[model samples]
Target: MVNLTVTQLLRDRALADPEGVALIVQGSAPLTYGRWDERSTELANGLVERGVTRGDRVGLVFGNGDWADYAVAFFGVLKAGAAAVPLSDALAPADLRFMLGHCGAAGVVHAEGLEVAADGWTVTPGVLRAEASAQTSYDGRSAGDAVTDPPRPDDLAQILYTSGTTGRPKGVAATHANLAYGCGGKRRPFAHSRHLVHAFPIGTNAGQTMLINALDAHPAVVTLPRFTPGRFAALIESYRAGTVFLVPAMAIELLNAGIAGRHDLSSVLLLGSAAAPLPAPVAAALTGAFPNATITNYYTSTEAAPAQTIMMFDPERPGSVGRAVAGGRVRIATPQGEPLPQGETGEVWMRSPAAPRSYYGDPGSGTFRDGWIRMGDLGYLDPDGYLYLVDRESDVVKSGAHKVSTIHVEEAVFGHPDVVEAAAFGVPHPVMGTVVAVAMVVREPVTAEELRLFLTGRLAPHEMPAQVVTVGELPRNAGGKVDKRALRSSLTAPADLAPAHE
Candidate 1:
């Protein structure tokens, strides 16, 4: 087995080119590998001195503005042989508290100027870095003395909390082996670019993936403080970033704001969309926006990292999310965990090449079985092995005897020229038990009757939306995914009377 750890990659990079730029936040100075290594080493030793031990979980609370420090803290936790639990500054205080308690965190490392009150010890990265400096200068001690035992490949590296759309957030624990599975290879990920730009917020799986890319990929990772259409476009144009990554919501906003019309984004050679499926319409618009880039959609969950189906936008198969690549396998299975036939819709399952991740406190979440992770998605595999997603298992509308896919309904709504974004979900009905309903955002004013007319031939009799509500924006979770549960709660009024719709 090829044994590797996450810190090993960073160490190799720091040794190879100490002066090379490693990370950069927009409007901030660049962070070099030499400094990243030095700072993280000191912080690791400081953490070890402050009672952190192997297998202990440390909480990292940070915002996008402090991404460089967050990066250093992440490596420091690994180097200290402690599992890092990262949480966003944007998360609610209650949620943050819940996650910290859930993991029984040993200590907390928060960003400067941010207030996080944990039951255990809490310190900012600046404070840790300062204390390390004092110890080195006054005591003439090296950080390596404290961190005698470096982390091994099998050691716990991180515990990331999921965006709790259903119940309380669950912590997913991953080992150093899981995070460093695909690294230490001859070919670098995103090798076509000098600088790769993205606006993914800190604490999400997508954000962590970009963090790993910063350590392993050839490109210098560039990110904005936050995702605004104008700011994101400006970063791409200014950096002439050959590689870019974004989710569907950002893609919709960029297209709606006509960012490509105003900015020179032709330098992008590889554009990746993740977090959620890229709607066909948005994917097509991205092709025009980044004329020189290959628009790719990646499908993977937080539990199934490094195991994803990658689809380069193909006009012939626009709806497919592509086949599993890079030693990952995809399968459609029944609820009972039995494999289903091709073209048969069922639960989606994926397996990674690395050690499978599991829930931290609760081992039997039923999401992971053997080595495969249940995706909680309903999809079917075509003859060519491409996977086509229908909808979330919970989001699928069970209208009496007929089942409705929200994706199909939304795709039809996106076919209209006026529609900017749309979300479809199930609504309770007396006669049908549950019926299809839609919430949409459009560029121009359009009534429910007009949308019904637009979807008349596009949908079947049962597939048509029973109610259509127009909203200025769709509610999103921390991970930037549309919160269907929130939408369902908001549309609890009279069915005939649509909210914000005439």
Candidate 2:
């Protein structure tokens, strides 16, 4: 019932614990709550003075390791009554320009030496101080605090861009209420110590979730600016972090690198992964990696967030994504969007009381319908209402005139002891129209025939891969989900990336 906003989440935290550690970035000084609040406030005032008004859009152009400035730009825009459009640091000039124009931002804020190709006024964190200093020429008290207005719960706080698997990325408009879920207006008691850890890329849904968790779930957040298997393990051990979140991709790397065994990772109490289904083997490996932590997998999307199905790892039901939690509801629906019987696979739809957001430019497009999001995934609810993901509707291959779930084959492939990761899709075959194809990464040398033999009885006859390929690694999008679209598009390229034959 607390009507607190995202800005209030930070303000309340600072007032309650001004000296509390807020952010911990490797090779940088830790930031305190009081400093974060004051710095963001100053930046908010600066943007306001530069004519960035309420309801305006402001772009955040920051790269990895620019956490401090990114935080300032993010909250400053929200506190200034403008929506923060967080652009990916990996964006090229063309992509950056499109988003800036797409969001129709009033201006862009970035750090010095951070290269970005864009138009309109460019504001930096230093500009806030510079403007405050320049005010001394008129009256010398100090522009002390920028008197910017706070946003309401309904106001758009952030416009996070989706991974654009289907087409160009669309801006997901998130209101204050959407971002402020689960904060409870105060920090959680430090169960093990005072820190939580994650290597989530900034500007991502997972990254933003960690940022919000740092505000109220724990006193400090330890971040891995650039993720590497060794670095990820070292940070958790170095900080004695109690809770951690990783996408399945990162978890696989950690297991492959075997750093968890080398590091003292027993301090972890909560181990969560999202953005993709964790294969049975990866889930089992993670339990061994963070032995003391509770392993959890969450199901959510950019279109339907804050509302998700959260499943604590249950070995008996290895593939389940878990039941809905945190005031969220999930249902399997027919193509017409009507609810289907339990255990029937169809489009997965999510409903949340957190006041759902919409696409910025195309409001209420087919995806958002009557308090529900299409989720773009095909899944089923167990007789017990436990949800299980199958595959993206678009990624489900029609092979040999029968629909085949890539996940079905991938799951069987992952069950193999030596397979590290696997991706299955339908490739054009003049005879079958489309035939099942698989690409994989393995722990040791394994031939395609060996894998095909292993999958013989595990999958349906039609679901069996017509061809097998071995790759160095699976390509991932910004959200850490496997880029199946990119993989499908490049299947025609040279044999270097994927070695497969009809």
Candidate 3:
């Protein structure tokens, strides 16, 4: 059967390979397709019995240790004809309440020991058993009718909230067709590997993608309860994991901790970095760390899933995020929505081959138009059609008359051997509107002036940082992205710094 919906993927997989291992969490038992299907169905029956009807929204709050249960809850909501709003346990109580309320959720399915207060009914996975008595007092229809009438491809499958770095978080709703578009092929994804590993937390697009891969791909998914340099290395060595995925932050930690020499990572054939850009220095260092692996970087946003640029670490085009693959298209557009000439810097827009997703209530949002998604990034296309990012739209530093790319400045600063991590942003200046400032984490002793001198050869005079401060670490948002908004609040450039150039 061709799987057009998420529930069908599990149903078909369970029927074909009932005992095949689907998911494994470190320090926990493996879950087979048969058990996964049975447990999720049980939960779906429970949800239906509790008055969750078609098109209803259900919240799923889970921690990393609860990946197995989380997977069950995600599919169960679909089976009951409701959209699952998966949230991380790391979120604050107020944030959780705000999201659930914004969605007008009918109920929330939480992991055991996690406190969730929703206006609608709330139940934990433990009490969803057939034998366990119902927790909610709602007088609802029988479970049989709702579960039998499963959701269609156009029905809402999931709602993922943005990180809200710019403003309040917005919910991006995706229908079943949007998620299950390219997932119907006979050959499962990543077929060369027997096991795939990732540490993406719950409520993230990457984590949800992994869940779909576990359902549709050939390899059994493996993950850790928490991501640490040592434990992650041990898991790779222990499982001889062939496919490993991580963000740039984790990549930096692995390189800095020197875990490659301590553990035998020769089994890693494909090491993928996503959710953030991979700096050129970090990508170069990763090659030596995983000698047998092909380092790949993926670029996409929450609204543009299954439609990303995949760059396979080309030495010649180190900064290019690669052309759009998988039938997707990428183009540079002006602020007025006109396409720009090649090699011209402008707003980046990408169109997905799959059905597009939009803000839950605001389908008319300017972010999406005519099947194209504005990537919220500023970049240009090379002559060969590869995309090279200049900077984020919000991260561009505008000086007196010149606009500087923070990514360009950070990349130049990262070239320093002693520098571990760097973040560049705009700081207020009296003469110029805003001047460039940078914060860095370094290993060895290096003064601001010395680092600025090194950047002199790489960066233009106007693009250089006016102020440089050393820090032990950079501030990261809940989604693991650098918080430039927070940086702007706390850091200020020195008055005695060099003046901005015309």
Candidate 4:
């Protein structure tokens, strides 16, 4: 394995193909490989001049169009021996403030129009105005020469904040080796392919990893400022992209947008989905749409890279998430910490070298036990070694002394002919303590009685929803995971919807 830092990869690429296009955004001018190197070097020099130093944290708060500059900024920070903190663009102002403050960022780089209220120095595109001076030769030293004192592989390279769906966001400390291992391990096959299109927010770990992999492979990357089904199809057609990364919601949207016959997507070789579970129906739709493509689903978290198993596209195993990748192992244990028998449901635990060293600034210790990180997900490994996800442990609904897996109910409800999407949650019930209530987006008007009848054959009597509410849409988190907490808050008294009686 060629153990090279991300900065070294960029410098190597710049040296190999300076004139080749490195980045292309929808509205912005394309940046050539040479231009990217020069700009990053200039920004690194600028940051050094502006009081940034080794071990300092530099926060980045920008959208996709700024990825090129952000990449430069990120490498610049790394080159200066500082850590880069990339904040999500979708974060609320208060959450953003908490994260920036928690990370104790020395400075932040934002786009021109975003109004961030961090108590630190802010750098924007305006800093690039020093055209004549920005071109200075990286303080008169090349990147290769400045690497005499390169950072150790275990040194913190970046701090990525968790999605905070459960509570306050926590910073995940990632090392250069952790990232390089994750990026480099997946580098070869992707790089050898001719075409790959990435359509994720630039600040996300998925996005950063994809960027590094794309650059390392030197594949054609089609960037999108934000995901749109129409635009995605056009890019694939234009570039004849062979591989694509999509969140589950984006996959559904593509199907709803009728992408199968609208474009000649026959050239696509692989389709990967992550960030959330792709319902079996949607996965089937994708298989039908891209007959030649190998569809794969991955189970992972921001704190751990390639932490768990990956289920590659196989028609026989429809919903299985696959077995562990190289250097990773998984265990299924009960709530009381007892190991479950194979084919029994339990919480999923994973061990991988790519897992975070620790949560940043957290006083608590011993999160890892004998190299395994508890993933807090509910699932089981089949007797055949295939991994299956039941649902998020927190998402399980407790009603009338019975625990119901919301994913199971939602899957059954979504299997209904008229339903497009289904979200299940616990609603207040006077007698049952809490009752299973469901909200759905549908293609046709289906009465609550009809839905209950449809679910009768699919779910247990107690597991079926007590009341069904129709909604046009379900709220989602930044990564496009359905925000069940938000759905629970939107509920009115269950008396409004006609209650289903046994």
Candidate 5:
């Protein structure tokens, strides 16, 4: 009966709508609320019998099982008064090793196929679920005999690692209050529809957000384990999903692949994008593709859950991410840590009730101060308080005395008809201090000179990339964002990179 815990929420939904489809993964069986609650209870009781104590950290490694499996393990861990640690099925062996060791998990509850290598563990609840099918005696216990313990509102619910764009991923310790707010509660914006769809992968912050939202928002939560633009569009039609979510990278693929055109997306009423800013070009294309739908772009970080900025695509203010939502505040500050004038670009800081998170067991990033987070984004706020991002402060290139937005250059390159993917970065230069460079993936033949010419009108003379390297593919992180750091460190580093003309 804990109001703030995920366990209580799932139980309420199970009692109210036992037969409602709670989860659906591509090519797998649907899991109803009743079954979801039952499996979680069973697994929870099993974990308790196997000696998983309150506050114990249990890793979830569902490895390609239905997303429902991850869901069951997540709630089960919470129901047992244990914190859930979701392991990405896509993580490298080293990353996986680091997480397992870093969290000091007492046990791991993984699918039959998934495995984790760690030195020692006090428990391994994998056998608990593995033995469930054969143990009728295990489920024969009275309702009161199930796990009697559940996490409190302020208890650690999960530890999500950053996507690690710049360096090592840091674990974000979130309490039950943090993850349980939007779920199984009064309906909110994205959750109001009967069906909700998104292709977010497991282990990413956005994926965890959808998981939290799925509890009570929609009657059906349709998910794509793997996202191809065409597959993403087809699923919307197949399920007649009214609301769907896409990150910027996914949105770009949908537009360039022309997938939404191939499907009957008439059922879509809301097409939302998050994780990163939706490129102006991508935003425009989304509007055209889902003409019947309201296209929205949201800006928020993993650590700053529920506190976000939302915009419904205003062509007049193409770059604006919109004003802060309810309970959220945004401010622009100068590099010297002073508030900047409206319309002046500077470091962006945001604050909300949900912004009180800290890095678990690692030196803090110093991004979070007092009640606000630095956001690490450089942008301006208009007199009306609408926010517009220019670029990440660390990622922008210094050209001569002025800073150039690689995002701007990349957006222009993405606008090229033949370009499927593009990235812009700073390179060492003798006279200009540093110059802009680009790497791109194209579907058709296009000369570097042609692309260079294309940017002349779209970007300032100083902002134009001096070198462009065409590639078959651009590196991407598991969360689906382009790995700009990886790109900069690759053999294509501007130092020795050849121009596209060569």
Candidate 6:
């Protein structure tokens, strides 16, 4: 079993192939494995000199640049026996404050150009870079000065905050073992075969997982400083990358950018889509674009990744989320915790060794039952043991006595020939309690009456949207999922609303 900490993971890679390219960022210089490890060692020494101690929390706020520096910072913190807290740079200042305060971070390490204002103390990237390069004097002791008090499998390695789409964000405390289980423990029929092209921000769980798995398996990872369809295509062609991981929105943008036809991307072997469901049309477009690649979509959350089912497309199981990986079990249960049979829609619950042990600083219990974690998602498992997601439990629209899945309505609307994107939500209704409302972006003019009629035969009476709002674009989060709360607020204006039968 692989019991080493993330710090060790880097050290091992450094020892095995010091000259191999460990990180590459567009518009920046590449960092070799040996240089990456040595820099991390120096950063560790710097942190030690700066009073960073074991079990201390170090907050990191940065974008996807040559993050090998931050990796060194992370290892330095870990080697000093401290936990790392990486925050997405996309978050607003207020949100960043909430996360930093919530995590009780001792200090922060921010990027050179980002706007991060913290009260106590903050370390700039310049300082770490100078220290790593031995151009600046550091008072902290080196890793060799003190015996390594590395973290155990159960020790907390990092605390990641949730996206807070539904409610207040909760901190997910991931132990070294928890992350390792996600990286390697879950059973799969296939070994690591694809070179991953990661475009997500490194602070997020998706990025961290990609980093660990790539280093553990020594996959050639092509990094993009920022996600641009053109740049992504260029990297894939330049590196002859075999696999890629992208959110649905990025995939759609790539399709719109016409990068597939412009580049020689036939070397792509597997295309993995996660963070959100890939619309059927988008998935189809990708399949046509990358004909040689297999499309695999996984359903998971930040709290417990690789949790639930992974749907690898098969002709027989069109929308199935494949089967549960080893060391994990999935159950569909009612709100009352009653188990539902196959084909019955219910909340999806997952139990796995990789699941989060507990929410950081959350006193309330019941997040986990036995070993199962409530996924907060609505879905059903088919008779063939394939999982299908409908929508989030919080996003389900309650109209009078009926419950409607917004994703279903959105999917139907998006299927329209002229519609580019769509979102469905519940609006406060006087008589019905709540009514289904839809917001849409279209490529051409389409009347509300036309859309209502288009969906008449496609959706049930209760599922039919009472109003359709036309917009140029839908509000989205950093992960590219629809920001329904923002969409709800936008509908409050008079000009934005249109009658369904208009």
- Tens digits of per-residue lDDT for model 5 on 218-272? 6487887788888888889888888999888788778878876689888888888
Question: Per-candidate RMSD vs. true structure?
Answer: 2.4, 2.8, 2.5, 2.6, 3.2, 3.1
Candidate of highest lDDT: 1
- For candidate 1, the TM-score is 0.97
Name the lDDT value of residue 18 in candidate 4.
89
Q: lDDT per residue, candidate 6, 178-240, as tens digits?
A: 766634333321244435676877667677766665456556566877888999988888877
State TM-scores per candidate: 0.97, 0.94, 0.96, 0.92, 0.92, 0.91
| Candidate 5 Cα errors over 4 Å, as ranges | 1-3, 63-65, 121-126, 130-145, 188-192, 334-338, 363-365, 430-433, 491-502
- The number of clashing residue pairs in each candidate reads 0, 0, 0, 0, 0, 2
- Kindly indicate the candidate among 1 and 5 with the higher TM-score: 1
Better of 3 and 6 by lDDT: 3
Overall lDDT per candidate, in order of appearance:
0.89, 0.81, 0.88, 0.75, 0.78, 0.74
Best by TM-score: 1
lDDT (Cα, tens digit) per residue for candidate 4, span 1-502: 3355666666767898888776677677777777766666556666676777778898888787677666666766776677889876678888888888998999887777877788888886448325325353454665323322466677788898877777677888887777766444444556534667777776566776676765666575667787788889888888888888888888878887898889888888889888887788778889888888888888777765747577887768777888888778787886545678998889887777553456889836444555566676899887888988887888887776678888889889978888888889888776676778899988889988899889887998778888788998888877677887788887847676444334
Number of the candidate with higher lDDT, 1 or 6: 1
Identify the runs in model 3 with alpha carbons over 4 angstroms from their true place. 1-3, 130-146, 493-498
Clashing pairs in 2: none
Q: Between candidates 4 and 6, name the one with more favorable TM-score.
A: 4
lDDT of 2 at 18: 89
Model 2, 233-344: lDDT tens per residue? 9998988888888999999899999987799999898888988887777888888888898898988887898888888889889989998887888999987789998888
Quote the lDDT for 285 in model 2. Answer: 82
Model 6 TM-score, all chains together: 0.91
* Model 6 spans > 4 angstroms off: 129-148, 182-194, 336-338, 493-502
Model 4 steric clash pairs:
none
Once all C-alphas are superposed, what RMSD does model 1 give against the true structure? Answer: 2.4
Poorest lDDT segment (10 consecutive residues) of candidate 3 = 130-139
Candidate 1: tens digits of C-alpha lDDT, residues 298-386: 99999999799999999999899999999999999987679999999999999998988999989988999989999999999999999
